[model samples]
Every structure is written in structure tokens, then in C-alpha cells.
Target: MRSCKDYSAKIPNVKPALCEAAQLQDSKARSVLGRPIWSRDVQAQGAPLRVLVLGGIHGDEMSSSSLVFHWIALAQTPPSDTPVPISWRFIPTLNPDGMFAKPARRVNARGVDLNRNFPTPNWARDARHYWEERTRRDPRRWPGTQPLSEPESRFLLEQIDNFKPNLIVSVHAPYGVLDFDGPSVPPSRLGRLYLDQVGIFPGSLGNYGGIHKGVPVVTIELPSASRTPQEAEMRQMWMDLLRWTTERLGSSASTTPASPDLPKSP
Candidate 1:
């Protein structure tokens, strides 16, 4: 519970009780500064569909992590309507060092952007070129000396292999749009955010997981970095995501009701 309290304090819209209810487990993977990267795996009865939800890749987008916590609570209840039995793996804070930094940095302690440090196709060439030429060598978006150079990136790559999720949902912030990759029909909207289909970048998770690995990646760029949507709005986004997932991947079943633990809007 101490870890829950500590983590919840860093992000807006999340209280200690919310994180405690999430019951996050330490992955035993250490960050650049030796901070523990925590995760929670929720399994439904013989769940045929496996989905991975990741947040805090940039660390500064704390709201993304907040949303993951809320969803963890939402996922606890098996809605009678939706028959989509889901195996869920939630990584709430993938970049703890960056997230816990005094000012909440976008990059890790080593100054590498974990989001841009994945091993995409031609990463050696394209990653460097994109960093140097396209980004004008932006320090915040640095791809690192090599792909998977950071332990944080390596840990994620390991999850993609070990977990072998059918869909990967990566949450980010301050962009206010939804982006999807792979063969599935993308969700048109989640809450107020609409699909934008942003182009992929070198060594990006969307490119590595969604394009190269053939796994569907639903990237949610929330509207704000510091503040999350209201509880009703967040639940609406979760419901939309649930509906979309069942429609696209699960058995053509009914939609789910709200998590019983979650309070209704006033």
C-alpha cells in the first residue's frame, strides 16, 4: 500500500485508494534509476482474448497512468452483457524514473525517449536518421544510441514476446486523438477524442508492435497531460474501448455494463 500511496501522489486525478484497489504488482524490473516498474495482470475465466494496456512511456503524461488505474478497477467486474472474456495485462508506469523525476521528464534518466527506443525495421538507420534529420536532434525525442538500449524498452519488448497479446493499448497524452495500427478496423472515437491515424515513426512502438509484429495497437492520446477527463468521461472511453474490442477481436457478443465498484455520475 505504501507503493500505491507513493505512486498515486505523483499523478493527478488518482487517489491512494484508487491505486490500492488496482493492486499493482512489482514486475521486479528496475528502471534506469533502479525504480521498480509495476504491473497488474487480470484474467477472466478461460479468457480467449489477451490485451495489454501500457502507460507512462513518456512519464510526463501522468494522466495516461491515471487512466490505466481507473481502467484496472473497471476491469474487475465481468459485465453480464459482454461475453468477451479478456486476459488483461496492465503496465501502469513503464518509465518510473522519468515519471518520478522532480519535474516529470519526457525521457528516462539516461536522456533517452523510451517511446523512440524500440527496435523497429531498419532501426539502426531509420531511427538515427529520424532523430538527426526529422527531429533536428531534439533531445526530448532522442532514439538512443541503439534500439532497446534502455532497460525500460527492453522490458517492454520482453512483454510483447512473453505476453503475446492480441492487442496492445498504449496510452499517451496532450495530443487529444486516438491512433491505431495493424489490420483491425480502428475505433472511430473513445470519449471525446477521435481517430487521427498519425503516421508511424522510426523505432516507435506503433511501428514495432503494430506494423512489424502484426499486433493491433490502439494509441490513446488524451487531451491533457496534467489532468484526466472526468470520471464519467473516462468510463465512457473505457466502455467505448470495450465495445470496440469485442466488435473487432472477441466473439461477436453483447456490450459490457460498468464495473460495479465504479460509482455512477451524479
Candidate 2:
């Protein structure tokens, strides 16, 4: 495993101060327009709880990306004096090309919905029909020609394999609910802001991480997709997330190794 100090030296465009000396890995995969996908891993001694936070799988959901950037900024100057016991990895804006485009598209430049492009077990059989029938052939939810066909989705899968986070928090928008998969994560005080729990979709990250890999996935559907949350709201969400991880999921003495039996595209 690469140390934080090693990452600082090897990875370009990552400031040591911003990440607090965390290990950074730039995915070899790129968006259709060639935007690099970046992930920062904050390591802890012994076996630490691993948490992966993702935002902006859908480029149109600006708030998701904004909140992630806000979290990264906050990480530069953490509020609490006590150190967090978890190993945190943040991936801000996986679909940068789409995000940067005019009017911000929901899919990547290739028109593939990165979120629905994961290589789930039933991807081949269900993805097309689900996108066609359930979503009514909505271009926004297109699952691509095949699973992991898009570079962005492939990059995310690689990150999942490398990071092996016990918990995955993917931020989405306009739904205003907290949808969970894998093991049960009971609603907390903060969960009142997002009281509803939605079902999983075919070839989604939730299905890939939670159902297939046995990793817990918390899908935070923000109230709005157009605008970022207020500073107070964002901070509150962050605090709540920290509380949820520590309180709900018991702390561990050692970190578990990355699962080698992850699904792969044939």
C-alpha cells in the first residue's frame, strides 16, 4: 500500500495540505473527453474503518459535486481536535466532461449514464429493458451498450477494488431521501431530512456495491439538483455522516483486506 507521503510525491496536481497528506490515486481511465478521475485516500494506522464518498455520477446533479468539493475543502481544515478513526476516500465529479458542458448533461460525453453502467450480476439481462421500460427510454438513464463499457464506470469499479471501503456514500439529487442497500442502516435524527428509502435499480452502484459485494451503500438524495446546499446544511450533513458511521457501524480494531472476488467484465 502506498503511504500518504508517497502519494504526495507521485501524484501530480494534488496538494499535500488539501488532502492532509492522504494517498491520492488518479485513475487510468478517462471520461469521453479525457478528464481524469481522481480519488484521495486518507489512511489510518492498524485496521481502520473504510468509507468511500462519491459525488457527481450524474453530471446534471450539480449539488452532489459541490458538496463533495465542500467536503474536500473542509478536510483541509477539520473542525474537531480528535482524529477520525476511518480511512476516507473521496471521488468528486466522476463525469467531469458532462458537468463542464453547457446545460450540464446527466450522462457522460458518450451519453452513457455512469451510475447505470456498473457490471452487476444481472446487468446483461436487465439493464436494457429496465432503462427502456421503467425509465421509458429516457436518455438520462441509458445504461450504455454493455456493463462497464464507459471508461468512467470502469474507473469507479477499479477504485472499489483498490479502496475496498466497508461503507459507500454516493450523493445524488432532487429526490430528498436516504436510500440504503446491503446491511440495514437505521434512520437517525438527521435522516428525518431524508426520510424515504427507495428501491435499487439495475446495474446501479448500489446494486454492485451493496447487494453483490456485501458493502453498505448510503445514497444521499439531496433536496435539489440545480443548486448546492447552504453552508450550514452542508456542514450538518457532513457531521451527520460522521456520526452515522461511528455510532451505527461499530469501530474496528483492524482494516479488512480488499476483496479479490469482485465481479469483472468478460
Candidate 3:
């Protein structure tokens, strides 16, 4: 359970950029709303093992955003001669309009759930009904009128295309489990916490990237959205994630066969 204080030298003071609408607001709201924070490191050789980590796609999941910010702060310092050569891109909050809403909405300013707005093959056919049945037509889970309809979702897709991440870790909250999609590899301590693999939805990043595009997408569901992790828990989770990443990408261990029965997008 190491603290960021222990690696203070490695942490950089990176700032955030405001989204288009946020920039139009008065100074206070502009600073807080519709802002996206990112940290990038591309100092590796050849085509570096690109990794993208995102948080706060569902804006109500505030803890996920906090965890990502914490990780970004700690990862700012360049790694020293690490076995894994990687280029990291961290996005702390993608749906800032929802996250900064007075009561923190699950959907963005347009009332669309960014998570269900990716342009997956089944988006047109399955997103709306699946959301309706799953949450009893909850507004919180409403898919957009069409895939990639919202700016937030489109922005995420743009990053995926530009960065071409080898692995993506999207953090969510209050689910207390780890759900993974794509190729199979040795399970890690993080996966052990939530071994029950959840089914993928039509336009979920898991379905679009992992299932369809053959990329690994690991969704880390935090224990609670209402509360940030205690120091010890935060450190433990960070260590486990780092270990999993290094083992999966840096070593030959990642060559383990893909699961023949991996869930397919509906």
C-alpha cells in the first residue's frame, strides 16, 4: 500500500483542458464543468505498447474519476528502465457535464449515457431495449438516439482510433468487480476480486473494442461511488493493476490463448 507521497518525484503537475461548452461559461463553472484531464507518456521505443485508461464515463460514478486522477498524478514521472515499454494515456473524466451537474447525472448534458453510445455493430438494434430491460427504462441508462451521437462518446472513439491502444482500462463504480473482455491470459489479483465475468452490452466499449476489435478491455468496477477508497485500499488496487499490466504486456505470459467461449456482442 504505497502512497503517492512515496513517489512524489515521479508525479508531475499536469493540468486539464476544458470542453467546448465549459470554456464558454463563467470562470467558476468553466473550471469545474465539462473538463477533461489527460496525461500522456510516449517515451518508449518502436511502436510502444499503448495503453489507454479512462474514468467517469458514467458521471455519477465519482469515485472512478478520483481513482483515475490519483493514478495519473502518480504515473506522471517517467518509469526508470522498466521491463515493460509502454506509452500511457490517462483520461480522468470523459463526461464532465454529467459529473459536474448539481446532482451528478449518469448521462451527459444531452441526457445520453456515454457508455451505451459507442458505434458497435449491434448499437442500432440492441442498445435501447437492453437498457430498458436492464434498468426498467432508467433514464440513467438511456442510450443515445444513435451510436456515437454524443460528443463524449465520439471523443472516446477518436482517442481509440488515434492512440490505437493495446489495452484499455475503463473504470466504473459501485459494482465491486472486475469484468474483462477479449483474449484470455492468466488471471491476476485484481481479476480475482471479481471473477464473475459479466455479459457485454451492444455498444459497450468492451463489446466494440475487446470483442470485435481483438483488444483487451478491462472494466474495473470500484466498490462505491459515494466514497473514495481508503489509503490502504487505493494502494492495494494500484499495485495489483500495475502488476497485471506488466505481466500481461511485458512478458511472454500475454501469449496465453484467447478463450474459445469468450462472450460475443449481441
Candidate 4:
């Protein structure tokens, strides 16, 4: 039974983690909440494809939180080279206030669910006004007075604008569903691979992303807040995702022009 004030205290100050991930002397970027947010650059020489991995959108979704943290750990020593093929930008935890303060609180310091707070086209017309109709005893839905009202939501919006990733993955929990969304259809293999890994029904992040922007977004749902799956299950899902991404990248790379040194001779 955490009160709003109590929950506000739990939001982890992401500054420390963000700095560590970007390996920046100091984080120059800031989230909409005014917390420090950082970006690490892994540039590719040619038209490098960009991907954004956002986790912890829901405060209580521990598996998603763990996954993003794992990714940040990897980024600390990411392969260093120009034209690295893929540039990954991670927002390890979006709702720091919700995460640290109210591990139980799904919403922010203001009691707004960052996910539902997104600026959907019909936001105003949304009758439920999620906050007023919260489902949980210690629930997360409450869209604030308006959409994009909370800082965390705004922070994500900024990331979308600056990074413009070709793909976005938003992780959530308890349903074990892998939702694929975007303006265009997802690769058929993706749907099957996700089903094989997480073992839940498929879902769509692009339903909202599509209305706002045409980019594809996928939501990877985990089992639940309290029940963390076995490591083997988690590993299998990630491996599948990696395999899919790798195959896609390989196809893209093959279409590229011949190397500089050999091309001149021709």
C-alpha cells in the first residue's frame, strides 16, 4: 500500500547508470523529467541502421528491467569500429521514479502510467481516462491530466525524435506475449521467432507508434512481475531475437557496394 509520495521516492536516479552506459565524462543529455539521459554512439560508416531498445517502461516489470540492464552491461564494451553495421541506442529504464520509488507502483511520481501516457492520435477522445479506471489494487494506469504530461513519457518521445530508429522494442510483463507493431508489416520470421522464444501471444507496439509515426515497434512481454522465468528460458528468447536481427543485417550487408580498395581496380 504505497502512497503516491512513497512511490515517488523509489524512482532510481538514472544519472549514474546512464553515465556508465554512455561512458560519458558527464551526461550532457537530459530526459523530459530533467534527469540526466545519455546516448552512446556506435556509428557505422555507411547508412548505419538504428535500433532503440527501451525497457522498464512499466515500473514493476522486473524481467524487462533486468533485460535492459543486461544490455547496458554489454554496451559498456561494445565492439569498437566504424560502420559497425548496427547502432543500438538503449533507454535502460524509462520510469526511474516509478522503478526505484514504487517497485509496486506502475505509474510515475504523478501516478501516470508512462505507457498509456503516450501521445496517441485519439488520446483526448479516449473515454476510459485510464487513471480514473485503474485495474490493480496498486495499479499503474492513470494517464495524468493529459497525454505526454509526465516527464518519462516526454523523455521517450525525445529519444524517438533524436534517434529515429528503424525499429523500436518496448518490453513489458506478465502476459508472455510478443507484440509486433509498425507502419509496415513485420518480417514473417520475426513473428514466429518471437512466439518460439517468449511463448506468449504476439502483440503490437506499433499500434500506437503507427498513429504517431510510421516506424515499427515491437513489445516483448514477459511472464510477470513476481515470477521471473528461468535463465534458460530468458537466454533462448534473446538468442532467437539475436538470430533474427543477425539474419536481417546479413541480408542488408550483402546488398552493399564492393569494398573501396577493390572497386578502383574495376
lDDT of each: 0.88, 0.72, 0.66, 0.54
Which candidate comes out best when scored by TM-score?
A: 1
What TM-scores do the predictions have?
A: 0.93, 0.81, 0.76, 0.67
Q: Candidate 1 or 4, higher TM-score?
A: 1
Give the lDDT ranking, best first.
Answer: 1, 2, 3, 4
TM match of model 4 to true structure: 0.67
User: What C-alpha root-mean-square deviation, in Å, does candidate 1 show against the real structure?
Assistant: 5.8
Model 1, CA-based lDDT: 0.88
lDDT of 4 at 250: 41
Candidate 2 C-alpha lDDT tens digits along 25-76: 6645678888667666554444356788898899888778666766766554
Better of 3 and 4 by lDDT: 3
TM-score of 3: 0.76
> How accurate locally is residue 211 in candidate 1, as Cα lDDT from 0 to 100?
95
lDDT of 3 by residue, 147-219 (tens): 9887677777777876677789898888888888888572444623554578888788888888888888988
Report lDDT (Cα) of residue 149, candidate 2.
93
Off by over 4 Å in 2: 1-25, 76-84, 189-192, 252-266
